[model samples]
Target: MPEVVFSVDQSKSMRDQAVPGHNRWHPDIPVAAMVRPGDEFRIECREWTDAQLGNNDSANDVRDVDLTHAHML
Candidate 1:
């Protein structure tokens, strides 16, 4: 199993704004306050199904993407 740590950023430049990305349309939260000593966390940090595909990409090209697995993190 692997682990990822998310440290809270208290930078003065931090702002309350919407994050633009896949599944991230909401306002950003204070990362420092979210995680606790034993809280569980995991993220699928891999190339998405549509990453290298172009506008003319076909259905077969989009299928069978290697989805990220769940490891202890």
Candidate 2:
């Protein structure tokens, strides 16, 4: 994987908001705080089961989803 760096802006409005879907990356604490200009990390992004479930799947699949084992994109 290639190295990634974040340059974030910390403004008053942003401080009160949260990053959707990522509890760990709150607006108050920008990604810049955790990474430098040349740091690298394995980033994993995942979607809600309800959002990605196939048409053939039942609602039960979403209800039964185990967040702990959910796939990361």
Candidate 3:
């Protein structure tokens, strides 16, 4: 496999949701310090849903999501 390096943001926003198949949103640790020129890796990212919610939305089908449940991830 081709080696790759990654520089990720580990903020709470970057943390993974509790989706059934997936565990966390991002890697447990940072790899920017350990990655070499040829190392390859994959990155998991959060969805835009968390960022695009309005206060008016209250129902499950509403576009405005509270992001309260991990299943939304």
Off by over 4 Å in 3: 1-33, 48-73
Better of 1 and 3 by TM-score: 3
Candidate 3 lDDT over residue span 1-73, tens digit each:
4433322342334343332223335676333335546657654444444334434455644554555543323
Candidate 1 vs candidate 2, lDDT winner? 2
Worst window of 10 by summed lDDT in candidate 2: 6-15
Residue 43 C-alpha lDDT in model 2: 38
Residue range 1-73, candidate 1, lDDT tens digits: 5345432222211122132123233355334324557777743332343243335758754564433421111
How far residue 8's Cα lies from its native spot in candidate 1, in Å, is 22
Ranking by TM-score: 2, 3, 1
TM-score, prediction 1 = 0.21
Where does candidate 2 stray beyond 4 Å?
Answer: 1-33, 47-51, 55-73
Model 1 weakest lDDT span, ten residues long: 11-20
